[model samples]
Target: MKALDRAELQRRFPEGVPVQCGKSSSSHLVSPNEIFAVESKMFFLVGPVGVILSFLSGGVFVYSNWSNVLGDDLAFLFLVPIIILIPWLIAYTFIKNERARISLFNRHYI
Candidate 1:
């Protein structure tokens, strides 16, 4: 996307523009979206990454702690499921919120 001039931004988004920008990276908001569009995009982009990372981290922890786990009772059955579930809850929340945000943004912005 091309950079927008001040005049263009004002013209395009008179109310306000939502921008998502990465920190500590060479990133900039190329354009602004309605709050809803930005939020939906956030869900589409960041939700999966969060889910995958959580699963990977949980797997690594489970693998590294297998010896300790088995030495105990069926603690793993409880612990492992919890570990998997927490991330799912978080991702599900993001997705639901994203959908809501998008819907609300569309209702007002569009």
Candidate 2:
């Protein structure tokens, strides 16, 4: 996205934009509510770590079943993907929000 100039920013958000991370200055003030909101919003920032862990769990599951009778079960094969998919979504949300926050901070707050 194209970045707007200071004048445009001032015109767009006359009250000033609330920054979640970084130091506050005379021009940038942090409000308690804004801070709370930002912190809450930042809760999902696990990124690739979550994804890696999810994959690792899948790997362990596959390895455990490789030499066992469970591997032959059709239900187990179908359920493993579905089971890991729940955690994958959590990981995905975390990664996406983290990237978005980083981009927003770099583009506007720096």
TM-score of each candidate? Answer: 0.51, 0.42
Write candidate 2's Cα lDDT for 8-85 as tens digits. 445555676555444644355433223211223444455455667777888888777876434467777775687668
How does candidate 1 score on lDDT?
Answer: 0.62
lDDT of 1 by residue, 62-84 (tens): 89888877686577668777887
Best by lDDT: 1
Task: Please list the Cα RMSD from the true structure of every candidate, rounded to 1 decimal place.
Answer: 9.1, 8.5
- Would you list the C-alpha lDDT of every candidate in the order shown? 0.62, 0.55
Could you say which candidate leads in TM-score? 1
TM-score of model 2 (CA atoms): 0.42
Error of 1 at 93 (Å): 1.1
Error of 1 at 101 (Å): 3.7
Per-residue error for 42 in candidate 2, Å, reads: 4.9
